[model samples]
Target: SRFAYVRDFELPDRLLPGTFILLRIDGHAFKQFTDAHRFAKPNDPRGLELMDHAAISLMREFPDIILGFGQSDEYSFLFRKSAALYNRRQSKITSILSTFFTASYVMHWKTYFPDTPLRYVPSFDARVVLYPGIREVRDYFSWRQTDTHVNNLYNTAFWALIHQGGQSKKDAHESLRVRFAWPLL
Candidate 1:
């Protein structure tokens, strides 16, 4: 049958083995989704806790995960480069990671927020990046941590201006722009 030819289009290419693989997954449209669901601002303890639980579940379910690092709505799962899971196919790896993480998040959400039902569907996107050496992996983690720290500071300041300083959203954003313009000493 001519229609059966469509089934053969699946692409399969094994990623090169023998390198550190980092699969990072990030929430899609999380800001608006969080706002619609009324998540607490600055940092949501319940949300963060849910993320941690999901990451732990991933590590337990897949023994190949060496470590899991997460901040906010994103998590990075580290796997030994030698793992042959899914034949090291990029599409398979990324799709599975994203789907699994999203499922975990949804499954754990009710435990954290019992009364609040998920108002809408949630999803995550994932990518696999290879680090050739220990130094690059170290730098990658350092960079992620630094990024989280700066974002936290900026968000904290932004929210403080609204709550404590009694400034409007626009004003708070403007203030942040000016305050963060100078480099840290």
Candidate 2:
């Protein structure tokens, strides 16, 4: 019991009160993982569905989470402003949600990909952000959605250049760079 004082070294990590808390989780090194597992280009329906299922499971488990937004290999969960879960502890909330989502993804993998075998375990990284009001929350989600749309468009064009236009990887990148360049001659 003498060593219990070590607990005092832990810093206080409570989130701001009267603020909406968002826990966002993203797949770590998922581009390589997806490539290794041969996920469909631009987007994979199975992977997206699996992420949605995992998010739904988390929402069900933590009723305080009011909304979830997901695309590609990332998801954002928004908690009610009045939620007192874990006393709004940052580390506790993020760690639990990340672990739960990752476990749920692995557990439900077979259901989504019955024919494709899992090559290796997948993991996710998480962060907790606080928004002072509903407007900020809406802006955050809008930013994420816009990011998804822009990324999808770029990836589709990149892949199309490689597969359809017979461009090498480097050439495809160059093509996109030129196309995206400002003040084109």
Candidate 3:
């Protein structure tokens, strides 16, 4: 017997062709992973190199990817506004790109870090967001880059206080607050 059709079945959402698409992927529990692997603080040359290699592979694999920006454990891929890949399906686009990047990273891990074996398979999550115009997209990326810089500064200082200055986590945070004249706790 055939089942009855349901009205509330999965709804379909299609990204408009004229809008720019950004697919951002981030490592899952990357902080713990980094700590376990003893990744160099502030910047890990080998880790960055691995991410770059994976990104390059992603670009080469998908011609629709216009540009990519990556720092630390995240990468954002920019697709042309007119791209019709996978019929501009948000779920398909994000899932495929994220999995592909994770695979590439795993495949090239050895090339970057020979001594440290991958303890477990790393995974990533992705989301696709649309921007109505090029200006908005540009501003969006500019904002992201600026935030990255600011966060990097904070993290670098925090780690320095812990490592070099021999301060506890709470003391380091308080020190940063006092040094920067930040009133909020």
> Model 2: residues >4 Å from true position, as ranges?
178-185
Residue 30's C-alpha lDDT in candidate 1? 95
Best candidate according to lDDT: 2
Candidate with better lDDT, 2 vs 3: 2
For model 3, the stretches where C-alpha displacement exceeds 4 angstroms are 1-11, 178-185
Q: Judged by lDDT relative to the true structure, which candidate is superior, 1 or 2? A: 2
lDDT of 1 by residue, 1-185 (tens): 87998878976677888888899988888998889878898888999999998888888878888988899889988888678888788888888777877789898899998978999898887899998888988888887888788889899889999999999999998888856624431
Per-residue lDDT over 1-185 for candidate 2, one digit per residue giving the tens place of the 0 to 100 score: 99999999999999989999999999999999999988898898999999999999999999999999998899999999999999989899989889999999999999998998999988999999999999999999988988877778789899999889999999988988845523221
> Distance from true position, residue 70, model 3, in Å?
0.8
Compared with the true structure, all predictions reach lDDT values of 0.86, 0.91, 0.86
Highest TM-score against the true fold, candidate:
2
Where model 1 places Cα greater than 4 Å from the true spot, the runs are 1-8, 181-185
TM-score of 1: 0.90
Backbone clashes for every candidate come to 0, 0, 0
Count clashing residue pairs in model 1: 0
